[model samples]
Target: MRIGELAGQAGTTTRALRYYEAHGLVRPRRAANGYRDYDEAELRVVREIRALLATGFALDEIRPFVACLRAGNPSGDVCPDSVSVLRRKLAEVEAYIERLEAVRGQLREQLGGAR
Candidate 1:
């Protein structure tokens, strides 16, 4: 398929696809007329990248996942580097929850005092 077709199938724009290429994430071969010819496997890789991006993962953070996919892993369940990134993100989420709980407690106290 071509870049446009892959982009449509991957639910992203050609610009985003080009950006992914710029970052060395998606590598498509050049067609005879100099157009980018994408492989079917690229659909899987692009989907992975989009899914990770939707979850707040930066491009750098997504590299490991892409690497794992290129390494012939069909499922999106591998990648030790991604595991590490997720662990850190989980910790950050936990800390945010703790801070929110503290704020809730403060608000409760203020409400009680006002009452």
Candidate 2:
């Protein structure tokens, strides 16, 4: 398939696919006419990349998962590196939630005082 077909299949844009290729996330081969030619596997990789990005994963943060996928894992997050990334993101989310809760408490106290 070409870039447009892969983008459509992956529910992303050709520009995004290009960006992914530039970032080393997806590597589509160049066709005879210099067009990017993508395979079904690359389409799967793009879907995985988009899914991870939707979950707030940075491009660099998603590298381990991509690596895992490229390594032929059934799921990207099964590898140790991907697992470690998940753990780190989980901790960050937890800390962010704690901070937000603290801020919420302070806001509630301020509102009560204002009343």
Candidate 3:
């Protein structure tokens, strides 16, 4: 397949695919005519990238998962590096939730006093 086909199959854009290439997430070979050539495996990698991005993972943060996938893992998160990233992200989300709860409490107090 080509860049456009990979983008369509991955539910992303050609621009994003290019960006991923630049960032070393997806590596497509160059055809003899200089066109980008992708395989089904690259399509699967793109899908993994998109799924992680939807969960608020930055491109850099996704590097470990990509490495895991490239290492032949059936699922990227099964690797130790990927697991570590997930743990870190979970902690960050927990901290964010705590702050949001504090803000909500303050807002509730303000509303009650206003009434």
At residue 7, give the lDDT of candidate 2.
82
Ranking by TM-score: 3, 2, 1
Name the better of 1 and 3 by lDDT: 3
RMSD of each: 1.6, 0.7, 0.6
Q: Candidate 1 deviates by what RMSD?
A: 1.6
Write down the lDDT that model 1 would get: 0.89
Model 1, runs deviating above 4 Å: none
- Model 2 Cα lDDT, one tens digit per residue, 2-105: 99899888899999998999999999899899999988889878999999999999999999999999999998999999999999999999999999999999
In model 1, which range of ten residues has the least summed lDDT?
A: 74-83
Q: Model 2 Cα RMSD, Å?
A: 0.7
TM per prediction: 0.87, 0.97, 0.98
lDDT: which candidate is best? 3
Taking the candidates one at a time, how many backbone clashes does each contain? 0, 0, 0
By lDDT, rank the candidates, best first: 3, 2, 1
lDDT (C-alpha, whole model) for all candidates? 0.89, 0.93, 0.95
How good is model 2 by TM-score? 0.97
- lDDT for model 3, please: 0.95
- What TM-score does structure 3 among the candidates reach? 0.98
lDDT (Cα, 0-100) at 35 in candidate 3: 96
* Clashing residue pairs found in predicted model 2: none
Q: List the residue pairs that clash in candidate 1.
A: none
